[model samples]
Target: MSDPAPVSTIVFDVNETLLDITTLEPLFERLFGDAAMLRAWFAELVLYSQAVTLSGKYTPFGELAGGILRMVGENNSVAITDADISELKSLIVSMPAYVDVKPALDRLRAAGFQLVTLTNSAPSPSPTPLEKAGIAGLFDRHFSVADVEKFKPHPDTYDMVAKAMGVEPSGLCMVACHVWDTIGAQSAGWQGALVTRPNNNALHAPNVPTPDFINSDLAALAGQIIDANTAAGKE
Candidate 1:
């Protein structure tokens, strides 16, 4: 087999890789007060993401978020207003970071890796979930697909991030919990690391490529990146 590519910069996927999405469950339950409805809303959000991509229909991620919220409210017998959706969007901006994310980011920075975030989220009027996570300053830069009017699994989205960081695709490592995101990055010629979380199960999506490395935690993936860089004389 060929040698592993050297990693100069690491780009993280924001939602599940760095942020703890579980926090949203309780918040949503409290806001809507119906467990089943909240779950269905989240499920539909994922479904809509795929549907939009497959249908070649481009919608802002925030709009999709609002749509899911409206569907849930309607299902739960609550009439949601524009104001209610706006408040829910604000809550998303304040979602907490995962426990392991900050330290892992610190370690990567200490090891001389530039860090950044490439997310499918829209550029919004308020602070993003990254700002709420308190690690907003940790990243060298942040990119949203809204800038390109595309979403994850799209090659242009990955290219946008690589171009912004001034790095060739091969020199940047895309770290994400979702296989599709990693596959997209890898196919676009960037190295990818799969940060496995409980809900990510490597679904058998046709034409999706596997990631370069798979680890259960960010710290472990950070170590691998450091080692890879050192081996390639990049450290």
Candidate 2:
């Protein structure tokens, strides 16, 4: 290809992409004796989030997360009580941001790029996760999949961002740690950057399209996006 479209807006994914999911690991460990239970429950949460979308039904993300925690606990023969579920959900809004997230967001902001967040988390009045992460001001707005009754990897979910920004999806760059999220955005004609966080990378499949940019973390990815925008005279 001769050239790629410049990204006028950058949309971030909240969970592990910006906020560190491990912040809630201790709760899982206390309840299940395995901190890895947090990861397992999260996997189920995403799976069910997609499963409901495919079934033409909707479930709020927090509800799905709490339900999945029970499923994961049951799989290990632990009887997860309602109190246990509540305990975990209560910690969600307070999860900490990744150490690199603020610096990355700050760089993008200083370079004249619009930055915002798109999270699968259902909206709540308890203050957005970014607020709890201490990076709320870094984003212009926080969009949730709950608004569209769809989860990520769905084409409509990606379209919502462009519609909200009043720009064609091609003018937006979706920065996410999950390849599936990036793939969905690209399929909807948006630019994409894969954050390639630990245990997270693009799938190596024949039909899987790669993201326009890939880096080990948001800090490096921000640098790459800044360079690309500069080279394209967007800076």
Candidate 3:
């Protein structure tokens, strides 16, 4: 096998990786009496998005989020209405970037890496997650899986990143907090970085593509990328 490819461009996963979804925990707690259910609901959102996509039907992320939140509330015997879902979604746009995100973006950009975002969210008429977090200008391009009608962890969705960024898959590195995302991207010939988030773990399944760099947060992952490139230059 050829040696691992170097990263020429970095594509980020936006929702939990850049904008912290935990900001919505209080709303879940108020409605369900348990903040931790927010994590479960999000896990369902991701699963259902891919489940339908894999079955050759596609549902947009926001719609899946609404449906899953209702399911979760019903399971807990809480009464969440359509108006409550709308109110919860309204909070999505106002989430601040995670503490590690801005410095990591600054470092990677300054070190000459082209930055881009590829999210599962549909193209929105309103400001997107990055725009809402005030970092839209940091990206060279922003792509949504809506363009391909597929949610990520699908090889097709990961493959689209290369075309959107005008590079070979090997020249791209996917930075994500989810192991499945890293696995999908690396499987499609890109390098991968995993940011260790709460309850997230290293992938250990047979034939899985392990992360090229695994760090506790984005700032540390950016440092890994920068240092790796600097060391390569010396040789």
Candidate 4:
């Protein structure tokens, strides 16, 4: 029997996976008088992004994010000022990476994996969030859903990465903090590795495809990928 193909390309989801989103809490607290509104706004952003995609409509993720923030502010009876939106945008593009991200990415690269990113955020003329976070140079490529006009968990979003990399879906592994993202990548025939970041985890539903690797620590997840690839005779 032949060995199965090894996953040589690791595709990462940017926002919460690599960048520390908790840093935005202060902005949310200032805007809505509640730090918890950070999560609320993010959830709504994801929900509406997918909703519009499913409805055969398209809106740039950045614009949609700003819209969601305003919607949250209005719901809380707080006015979202232009300056507030500008600050939010600045903070987003300047969010720092989780401490574990760089080391794990370095380890994976050393293990001979091609590392790249797939983000729902649209392309920016300025330095990207990853670039601003000081890790963009480490990636071989960065993909945005803006090109596909769909938000993630949509199969097309995952498929676009495989197509762009010129590799079969089976040759890729998606490393993400979101279960929905892993499910989408897996459904597109890529292996899934879920980094169980705070407030993120594997959802074990009978109909859902559980991730192939799950760890709270990205370094541990990198080790697992390395070990598996080594065992499969990847050099």
- Cα lDDT of candidate 2 equals 0.86
lDDT of each: 0.80, 0.86, 0.86, 0.90
The candidate scoring highest on lDDT is 4
- The residue-by-residue lDDT of candidate 2 on 123-180, one tens digit each, is 8785767777789988888899989999998998888888888988878999999988
- Cα-based TM-score, every candidate: 0.85, 0.95, 0.95, 0.95
List, residue by residue over 6-116, the lDDT tens digit for candidate 4.
788999999999999999999988877789889999999999999999999998887888888889888989999888888888888889999999999999999889999
Runs of candidate 1 with Cα error greater than 4 angstroms are 1-3, 27-40, 72-84, 204-207
Give the lDDT of residue 178 in candidate 1: 85
Candidate 1 lDDT at 114 equals 91
Off by over 4 Å in 4: 1-5
Clash pairs, candidate 4, are none
Off by over 4 Å in 2: 1-3
Clashes of 3: 0
